[model samples]
Target: MDKKVTIYDLAKELNVSPATISRALNDHPSISLNTKKRIVSYAQRSGYRINKFAANLSKQKSNTIGVIVPKLNSYFMSSVLSGIEKVANGHNYNLIISQSLESENKEKLNTQTLYDSGVDALMVSLAFGTENYDHFALFRDQKIPLLFFDRVCHLPNCPTITIDNRKAGADATEHLIQNGCKNILHVGGHLKRNVYTDRFTGFKDALNKYGLEYKPSNFIETNLDAAKIEEIIDHLINSKEKFDGIFFANDAMAVACMQSLLKKGYRIPEDIKIIGFNNNPISEIIQPNLSTINYPGYELGVLAGQSIISHLNGNINIESAESILLKHELIARASSSSTN
Candidate 1:
């Protein structure tokens, strides 16, 4: 095997001090841009890999961030993560990412493992059943700068970043109502989560404001998984009243329900108009297209990353800020259009 190149080798080859190379590698602003680029290029060409353990030992920091999300295989989640990675990488920080598979037990376990691995900070989007947030106590106790996004709860000293899910929900419901969807139904996720609970609140608000009588049978609390499509179909089919509209908490569920409805001989807007959240890419590809809410996932991630970094560097007191709410917009489409 070829010899492993060290920083010293690159410094020797480039005629720069080891300290200069180190500063350049850490992306210190003090290092001249030209010199930093030269050092980094030589280091990469010479196969000099960073020894994070040694670096962490010297600086007393891992220069790494940990992230936990409900699922990784989603457009919205992936977009958010991409934004986080972009910001973290620009600042010379590595990210350790894990998924909870929407399980609270798995989320707790992942938290423990990430903490044990010595992450400098942690960002989490809570799991469906993570009502007990005690697992995050270790991070708080250690002052590790914990943050929550999307699905969250109140924990002292921890900052949260999310869109106004309640308003977004109300907008979706109101849009359907404006399109003449009288008997509206709302398919939401577990109310234990703030995201779902808040949206459900907004849904009820729109109904109340529009003078539509809310019916118990018009609401269904689901796991919001795509696999729940069959159950949704069964529920819609068995409903005593002929429902004219639905507002799904996420795009995947809405798309699934729409497909099932089309197969069952239902005209999308004529028989049942629909709206969904997240504005997922697949929403436009579906037959009638989906009307939905545009939640800025990537921007939310970027803000969350910048917030943690700011907190760690003393640039901002994120804990004092408590929460950051991003903007959301409603996108109208053929699925909810009465004229289409």
Candidate 2:
């Protein structure tokens, strides 16, 4: 086996002290820019990788942030991850991203693993099944920076990043009402999640503003699994009550139900106008483009990265930091167009 290169080897070859080589490689201000470039160039050519584990031991920091999301396959989650990676990389921080797969136990396990691995900070978008947040107590007790986005919960001194879901939800519902939808149906995910519950609340807010009675029969709460589109379609198709509009909690399920309804000879925006949340890429690709709430998932991720990094660097006190709420917009499309 070939021997791996180290800082001592670089210092021996470069005729400098190990401390000087370390400072140069780390781009310390005391090191000249020319020295830094020369050391960095030589280190790259010699395949001298930084020993992060040893470095973290000295600094008492992993230089790695832990992130937990419900699922990784969705466009919104992917976009958020991309943004987080971009920021984390620019700051010389690595991300340990894990998906809970919507299971509370899995989320708890991931939390424990990241904590055991000594992550500098933790960021989470809570899972649908996460009813209890006791798993995060270790981080809080240790004064580790913890931030939440998207599907968030109330935890003491933990800053959060998210759009105003309730307002966005109200905007989506109001758009439908303005377009002449009198009897509207709302399809949401698990109410345990703030994202789904807040959006549902917004839906009702709009309904009440226009004097439309809230009907329990008009609401459907599920896991929002696209594979189970049959259940949603069956309810919509066989409902005894009439519905002229629908507000879906997510773009994937909305697109799935829209396609299934189209196959059943339902004309979108003509027979039933629809609006979904998230504004995912598939929203535009659907036959009739889906009207949706622009949740800005990527922006949320970027802000989350910046906030946590700032806390870790002591530039901002996480203990005193307030939760960040990003702006959201309502997008109108063919799916919710008014026939009039």
Candidate 3:
């Protein structure tokens, strides 16, 4: 391999001391602007790379923010990650992202690895089965800024960003009722998760407000797997009281449900109306466009990035801010609208 360019090489080439090169590269105020510019240009042209590990160890700052998510393949989660990368890169920070694959054990391991890697901050969206958050204590004990978005858990001093799930859920159910859907079924994810649980609470609250009877058969909890769509279809087909509407926790499940319903000769919004959360792109692509709550995953990520960076810069006291709730809106489409 060719000889790797180093600070010493650049210093020798520029006829400056190694200390001067180091200071200039770091953008120290003591170095003259002209000298710093020259050093930077030369370093760039020479393909010089700084050993960030050594520098991070010496300065005790990694300039890297760690992010943990349940999965990377989802449209909404990936969009959120893209937004985070945009803000972090603009601010000269790097993101180290890892997936938990909905496994709490893997999530714990990733948390420990991120901490060991000396990430300056941590952002997490909990795994599906992550009931225990003890792995996050290392960061808390060390006083590193930790932020949670979407699938969040309340850890003392950690800032969390999410929409008012209860309100959104209520809105979705109420919309269905307004469109003359009395016998509605809510397909949901794990109830252990606050997002789904809060949504289910809203679902019940709306039913109670409208004086509609809450039936045990009205709520179907699943992992939202597409493969299990047949089971839901079977339930819908065999139900004594036909469900006129459906409210799903996530767009993926809603889309799967819609497809299954269509195959069974149910006309969307004509026979049954449907609404889902997280205005994912698929919501638009489906035959009868799905009406959904616009969850704004990208904006959530940007806000999370800004909040953590602000905390790191000492410009904002994150501890004083307990929860940051983003606005959610109901998007009317062919699936849930009567007149559309």
Q: Evaluated with lDDT, which candidate comes out highest?
A: 2
Q: Which 10-residue window of candidate 3 scores lowest in summed lDDT?
A: 313-322
Taking all chains together, the TM-score of candidate 1 against the true structure is: 0.87
Give the alpha-carbon lDDT of every model.
0.91, 0.92, 0.91
Q: What is the C-alpha lDDT profile of model 2 across 73-101, one tens digit per residue?
A: 88899889988988999998999999999
Residue pairs in candidate 3 whose N, alpha carbon or C atoms collide under 3 angstroms = none
lDDT of 3: 0.91
True lDDT of residue 255, candidate 3: 94
Off by over 4 Å in 1: 1-50
In candidate 2, list every pair of residues with a backbone clash: none
Instruction: Give the number of colliding residue pairs in candidate 1.
Output: 0
What is the clash count for each candidate, in the order shown?
0, 0, 0
lDDT score for candidate 2 against the true structure: 0.92
Candidate 1 local distance difference test against the native = 0.91
lDDT by residue for model 3 over 45-74, one digit each (tens)? 988998777789889999999999999998
* RMSD vs true structure, all candidates: 3.9, 2.8, 2.2
